[model samples]
Target: MRSAVVAASLAAVALGITGPAQAAPARTSAATAAAAVTSTAGGSITRSEIIERAQYWVDQGVPYSQSAYYRDPQGRTYRTDCSGMVSMSWHLTTSATTWTLPDYSTQLGSLDDLQPGDALNNVNTHVVLFVGWTDSSHSTATIMEEARPGTNARKTTYSRSYLNSNGFKPYRYDKVVESPVTVPDKGMTNVTAVGDLSGDGVGDVIAVEAATGDLYRYNGPDYVGRSARVKIGYGWDSMSDIVGVGDITGDGVADILAVDAENGNLYRYSGPDYGGRSARVQIGTGWDSMTNLTGVGDITGDGSPDLIAVEKSTGDLYRYSGPDYAGRTARVKIGSGWNIYTSLTGIGDITGDGVADILAVDTETGNLYRYSGPNYNGGTRVQIGTGWDSMTNLTGVGDITGDRVPDLLAVKASTQDLYRYSGPSFPGGSAVQIGSGW
Candidate 1:
């Protein structure tokens, strides 16, 4: 966001001038993991898409300099400085200075108001695209910026102390549209919003009472606790591994899948009509040897939602092709040595990759790791949190709070209390106890 003078300084830096160095986010390569974004100017942008757009420049290794302008893939031109970089990322019609950028954004009161793809601006000094708070304590921030002359557009973490040392103010662009996950009272039922069971856009919780064996659907207000729940089925106490895989029956309505406790057989519960579930239909047999069962949405890139199972004996992971409605197909092995994890659950597409990701808790380290789709190769994990040794169950119940990120439910081993970790929060995770007597 610096002006002509800063541009000149950048030019000098490019021409062999330099200053105190700063570090960029650690990476195995300069290459980016996010896919490229193809967008035109002028329209609402989602937070994930904004990050994708910003990543384009980072992928290109666009250098920081004002003397020359940068042209985006959409053929838009903007200054090569920090603000110009933000302009391109936001897909602004034209480059806006730091002072003028405020015109298109709302100033936030505190760091907690921050979201990915927002901005932190110190007018006339600099502007950086706010990626997100690096930790739950709001102690550090991750940002993408054209940091002065000679430096390339980069992403790195900075301490809150340093960011607040300047006159930085948080701002969210007016046209920014968050992901479907919005917050409190946004159709979140008081009970867990596990997955959409009522064919509504908002996810509905399908919970089985431990003693009564009654399956209840919680739909209506957002988040867990006070939502209205209706008994949908009886005798679910004998079933384990309940999951709401997206529309697997090709019936246009989402269906619930569960494993019968007596047998390892998995059954699909497609509705009798559109309103209520039908009798259990066996789809897969001999699943009793599976250590984990998860219905990951469309992981195969096909229209059908797929499920993954970890072999109880070998610690191997296999994907069951969806539309396997008739019966289980030859399950495909996607990853091996999964037994090292104490738990694994399907988190609906945390990355904007169209395929759902898996969350695994390492048995030895108790580390929680998220593996982005399309496959779970061994080394692909990025550790998101640790100290999860006592977790008895982990369910990623899509997005509940509408934070443009997914929410997770973890049942504690010692207390059986249910804890919720709202989206995009990890490391310094914010675990809010949402329920008890799970």
Candidate 2:
């Protein structure tokens, strides 16, 4: 009898309970659509994309069909149920019911926290995408949902009181592609590092296949739809050993800097783009003790890119200004206890003060910290955000928001979803989903 009860519960959870009949309204206001596009800092799907997809349904006069599924322009199939419409808008790998969507979302405490790409969900029943707030008090919001059977997918306004009374819970999807433009990885996996390799102003992604020691680069954010794969010597299985990538040569184009995992030797490779025959220049040895590595821009005010490294044992941070191996200055001790950091990156001019800042994520708590000044020495340490432990990798991806201040790009370890955090600082800031499915 217990086994039967368990099975029944599982079934109930799979097929969520139906909610109130959806009101088939017209498209949302232009301001609401515009807000959706610009409100989120970074995501694979912008508010505009969501509005566009939802609008496509409206234009097609797509009637809600539990038995039939809607096919996206990419030829992906999704059920026409309420949850299915959300799944399609979210670009999820597969359709999910209301009960299962919370598993892929971060719960928001109140409707006041709602953003364009966020969602309203009642775990037992219905789900809706939040487009924008309808009133100054945020008591009412404009939303898009499939509504109910026999109804066409449409946008409608709902009062917060009505939604809360019906058990609707606000949530932000874990995988948000704030920007629709993306470069699909051509069978690449285990992205160890990312940077702007092509000097195109847009950041690119780097991946290393451990089994093969093969390195691949993909133009990102504004994906040009191509990749360049090359073998970087051999025996490079340790992802942590590979360090920074930037314009190390003082050239306009970016370069790749890596530490030999086995020998602790640092090497720099010059070639702004792929398909160019380039050779590696060994910088120095004794990098085996380095726990973390980052490219600090012109710490010495020199034209070339400088470097920062952390010692694994002592949590000591060092700044190395360079012109290549012998020309590089002696290591300058900058900070200590850096070993407690799981991820570190040099965010360019985060304060908009004409100086670069260092961003670090705590290993234990996932709390984010910013070290701001001309250099790491005597810089102020400010706590940015907590609960970033889900991040597997974090790096500075230039000024993604076009705000002059640099932003951060992060990858979730479990879902491999990409996120971007923008603003003058991370404190009181939020990350929007930029890419999904690794």
Candidate 3:
């Protein structure tokens, strides 16, 4: 049931570009290309956005050319071949050929598993979007694609049998959810902590200006230049007070949890941005005893943000599961002797076991250690590296490489230079300098 145009397009493309085509002179440099076609819109896109983008290509009445590339009104460029069309629809980082597209996707078992925004890709030749099912059997589907050279983009019906016969496989883009970004510094000095404040899965920096006791939030490193500063709150005058950032409410937006050094009280703040906070909900009364307070991420597996705190005097570690820290007895003692550590932060699933892990810097040596856990019960620990003593500040950043594993961001104390270090378990090696001068 494959449309004649789609079949012909496959044949035409197979005879066309066999590898990445040399981008035309007018095309933007690959490094400067947007992460997705609709990067401006921000956050994970809706299924409707995918469909609308595909429809926009059709509405443009762009005649297919093997080497034709179209720049949308928003300035994203799209090639007009089959994989190009799918790449544009998915807002891929760049134009990828059918053979290379699978590298950016997680393979699906069958056409029946396809979703509205999923793809039907014939490895090496053609790719199309699965809009919906035309039949309950899931054997036939409504697909959209740029047909062939000289043809216009169109929606057509295709049978699973026909697609499978042609070597078509199904895949979902690995970035179906937007990866976390790094927050740029905009006069952000003394960055005490970092977290995803905008809840876009990108990590923003939290800085306390010692001069004014004012706290500010900067959009993570996804933007081109220095991110604009958004003042979240005031009266955080002390640098000693601890701050933990995570989506505590499970609302998909990052929130703030802080321990006021003035009073030893823990507070949670709601966020879309940091401008306004919810009424202060005191999680604990005597936070002054807590040291190395950090967000450990669902340590209890309860689907809510769990916090880790070390007893200042004893170095005893405790995991506090929360509805909002109100339950007085929610604390579970996880380990002891944490006082030997100078810094601790969640590295976010570094073990690749689907559970968030903890990273601690040894106080005596500045060595970095990764602790794997089901719930921070002193689980297996491994030393990832040493020489972290040079870092003045360190915190868990959400995914920066788009590999789905969260990375570590550090600020060199002496230079204030920013560097992103990949999880040892991820694809890349350690440390890419992200910015200079803090």
Candidate 4:
């Protein structure tokens, strides 16, 4: 049971994530017919006239016949599923219930048929709407819909294929839609660790097959295969749990960081190509088992980038002073106790002190510890979460609510619950639960 708890906490920290410059919505095409209008004698109506009709439906929230469906054996009334929620949203947008059936494939085209304001049917269970694009290719797109129980409105990105082929098929209405749908940036995976290795200011991504030691890199837009990986001897073996990304090296260009599990070595991004640059730089040696690693932007007040690493086995924290690692690094031990550390998070100005601070999670107890100035040993420690929960991966920390200071994010893998804590200190604000119970 204890082992299960540790494993759960580690999994969540390994997959937290976020994004870049926002793009404008796609423009509508002229060849299509507006869904709101119907021709009586011959020709089509004007675009502005069709938009006026669609706006009328948007004002009135879509309604359903609660009095019509039968109750299940569990005494729950069948109101709506993922598809039903989407169908309702569509009716609100176009005021048409003509395609209200459970199947969306029959009404839509293949994934390629998708445009803005289109219905995505997993054919059987889920339904999502393509609303906007974020990238050069039409492959990644943003979706807005009522997907879960309490989430009536939410935004997430999906590849055109996962949005289509995961279900039986896709569907598209015959008429014209208000906007053109473009793909989103390579959709951010629940998996974190995305950025460019060439230091071009663009983010690149890398993925490793857990079953085999196969490694892959995401160049501009493609996932190119790299050499087979091997284990580095230390606390564990190999780069089993890893996050691949880029940064500017001494020359201010992008360099890669492939953190290995057992040895905790960082493989620097060599040149422009996504190949292994040089050998791996062994960060630390001894009984320290490194678990989580991250780039902290100039924590030392230097002009170059700095770093923070956490030892899941030992609760020790180390800070890399600047861009180069020629035996120039500083180490600070944060919290002390058996199993006192699980994940580490870097927030620029975490204390709102104009400098970045560090947050460490105690796995055994869901407590959060913060390190304010460069003096890691001087910061206050606070209890963030309690009662039967293990904090894994401090994945995302941002001003999600626009409070100016970022919230601490973690996942409780055992229950599959994502927890967010708003704070600069404890008496830590309330924790809100997000995502399906995890």
Candidate 5:
């Protein structure tokens, strides 16, 4: 059961703060911020990033104003008003108004075609950023927009039917792109984890090439295709496993923990800075006995993340709780007879219980089973899939899809193809190949 893999230690954070709509302050004078850029290169952005940028304005309580402009951290200036919020969220090179915003987008046929980061525009009336549909029929949606009155930048749950009937057209940024996917050229010998390591609100992959001991961070797959795999550091092959524990330090960036293969010493690497990691700090020792380790978020209901590991000798499963980011607490045996599984990893909160859960592939049967969180004991496991032994590192990739739920990424061992598993949850979800030739 003990195998070298880059286990996802990140918590089941759905784009972190992306899940909750931020509260807004009353309308105020336009806040001025420098660093806005207007260039062709500034227009390109991922779909998930669009929503993230929209959330930034909502979280910042930017007031609505057609005349005033503010520069975002990315160095893009936009009006503080409705269309301006859309422009800033889209990172459009030019600040467009409601009437002009449609010029830069492709009009959707109906509200059903609306997506996160898409906009519902009504010319001179007003416009709002489409978050996601809050209803099955897609008539109701969650939106982020800067409007007039007391609340300026705010998130709203509104009626799409009303907007559509009122002449609000769904517009998708013409240049908006889907996240691209890529795999390591050499192979899967490296330990890898996936999360928004870049803070782009889109999931990115981080891995250590075993042969060269090099750490590489892959940017989100761009729209046209290909994730830029840039090597940022060296000397990581010594780690037996790299755990991506999501934002454990409250920095809004995902942090990683690595296990020392030789001594089982654990070290913590803070969130990546432009894919460059700081010096690793030794967090704990004597972890050499864990046959396998992975993060299962907040399993103890303590609001902190938790971990699950199988013993090297007895195959007994144990859980470690944390007082903080590194839950390097004492292990509590939760179950036994787990050695029969070839691999185990975190699948996030697949049960929809708000707590992280575990996934295991049957060594002989190749079946995928879900063990719900908080002391994964008893026979309370659920069979989620059959013939899943082909996948390794069945790890949580966070809400990379921005669907407000946790999803997982796994590697097909035989083909080296990467796949994304998402649905309502694992038991209700299916896997789709995202990248291949790893």
Candidate 6:
């Protein structure tokens, strides 16, 4: 009963958000204002007081040594699961709060309707507190919670894919909320197309060819040879990895960010125009900067697009703010154990705190790390998936399973296997495997 409702609700969100309702807010300046509003809310603690409090608490370190886990009915530590950790945190923060919890099956709903304190359920497996979501498509989100198995209390990040895996089945919260879309797209396929094009906020099939310099976008509904092809860059070559979708240049339309393996050039394009070429520029200097770059999205709080590039040989990350494509702004180093073979994928909000955070996946080693903010000169980094299995592909950003904040969707790719992490709300650490083995 619980699963059936979550699947239906998310499918409805796909249809509604992508429909005509996503049009401009009656004015161009209004759109920019909307962007600003969205960006402002990206930070988890809105006020300096809360930010200071959070930092102060974290600086003191997780006080697990002084605390003991709440024993479940089975005598197991509730801290063993993600939701249990969150529940424990809530208890510690407020003397009034109790271990008695609400059923996650009923808490899922439109993200817009949720409050900061509300808890959202992810396919009934995990949970996280409500944090702000991105203005457009709510593609970006933030959550603060403890993550992983057999580990002490730690904050983690979650993305759209975490919830929407398995044909959006993983997210089953409440009944579908209805909002009429005003946009004139045909037969709901545009939602699928936009997903293919990279920024529609859902998990779709996308592939880029380095040899032919071609970009292919396909929907899960009909993935064959047919795909939207755009020739954004040149130099007779191969493309390696890609990340992010948005108006990187503050333009109203969405754009693409890709990396060229050979020259180490980071390219951005307005569109892939066959007649001519779209506006493209090379960002960053230095060896590893250009060699491997991944989009990190508005990291500097400047509202411009940002990129996190890793040196193929050193694994060091260079944060390049992109308002100035010509200069690529400032570069801040990230991560200590960087490796060339490691693949970095962007997750919305891992910490449950609203600020923009990123998830790094080590392709070679299959380890996962959640980076929260570029704060304190370099921000805070937490290692999550340092285990045997690694995750591939972030499906989308949303409360797929209905936890207040967005969760993440990951696929192994090799076997087309799907896995999910319920936000802090559903902390069982029991990753529910969905879909067929690819």
Q: Which number leads on TM-score?
A: 5
Kindly report which residue pairs in candidate 3 clash with one another.
37-91, 180-201, 181-202, 182-220, 182-221, 183-220, 183-221
Question: How accurate locally, in lDDT, is each candidate?
Answer: 0.61, 0.57, 0.58, 0.39, 0.60, 0.37
lDDT of 2: 0.57
Tell me the spans in candidate 3 whose CA falls farther than 4 Å from its real position: 1-201, 222-227, 239-242, 275-278, 326-328, 375-379, 425-429
**Residue-wise C-alpha lDDT for candidate 3, range 1-438, written one tens digit per residue:** 000000000111111111111111232322223334444422355555566566566556556777889865466888888888888777776888888888878899877787777788878667887776533334335677776654456554454434654677889876664333221122233353455556676566676544466777666653222356677777655324345556667776566666665676777766654443246666667876666666666656676766777776566888777656643376778898776664477666655466667777664454566686655655576666654544544666666566555656665432345666655432114556676655
Tens-place lDDT digits, model 1, residues 299-395 = 5566677777776566678887776633335788889877666556776655555556677776445567778777878887877765554444566
lDDT of 5 by residue, 1-438 (tens): 111122233434231111101222533222223222332435577766676666666556666676888766565678888888888888887788888887889999877887677898889688888876532334335677776633346664444324544567889988887663121133433334546666676667675543366777766532111255777777665566567665566776667666766667877677674232357777777666564577666666776666677665567888876533333356788898776664577765555565566767764455677676667764877666654543555655556565666566666543456666663345313556667654
Give the local distance difference test score of model 1: 0.61
lDDT value for model 6: 0.37
**Sort order, lDDT high to low:** 1, 5, 3, 2, 4, 6
* Model 3 poorest 10 in a row by lDDT: 1-10
Model 2 stretches astray by more than 4 angstroms: 1-201, 210-212, 222-240, 273-278, 325-329, 377-379, 426-430
TM-score against truth, every candidate? 0.52, 0.51, 0.52, 0.40, 0.53, 0.43
Model 2 reaches what TM-score against the true structure?
0.51
Q: How do the residues 1-438 of candidate 4 rate in per-residue lDDT, one tens digit apiece?
A: 000000001111211111111122333223222334433211333333323322222222222332232222122233444444444333332122224543222464355555555656654455655554333233335554434432223344444423433443455533333443332222211222333344543333343322233344433222222332122112211442233222545553344454443443455544334343244454434312443455555655656655555454444556655454323235555444323444455544654456555555543333455555454553365443332123343543334444555445444432234455554442223455643221
Count of clashing residue pairs in every prediction: 14, 10, 7, 23, 14, 52
RMSD of each: 22.0, 19.6, 24.3, 16.5, 20.0, 21.9
Candidate 4: segments with Cα more than 4 A from true spot: 1-237, 240-246, 250-256, 261-264, 270-291, 310-316, 327-339, 387-389, 400-403, 415-438
Best by lDDT: 1
As a TM-score, model 4 comes out at 0.40
Better of 3 and 6 by lDDT: 3
| Steric clash pairs (candidate 2) | 43-177, 43-178, 43-179, 43-433, 44-177, 44-178, 44-434, 45-177, 45-178, 176-433
Model 5 stretches astray by more than 4 angstroms: 1-186, 189-194, 221-227, 273-278, 323-329, 424-430
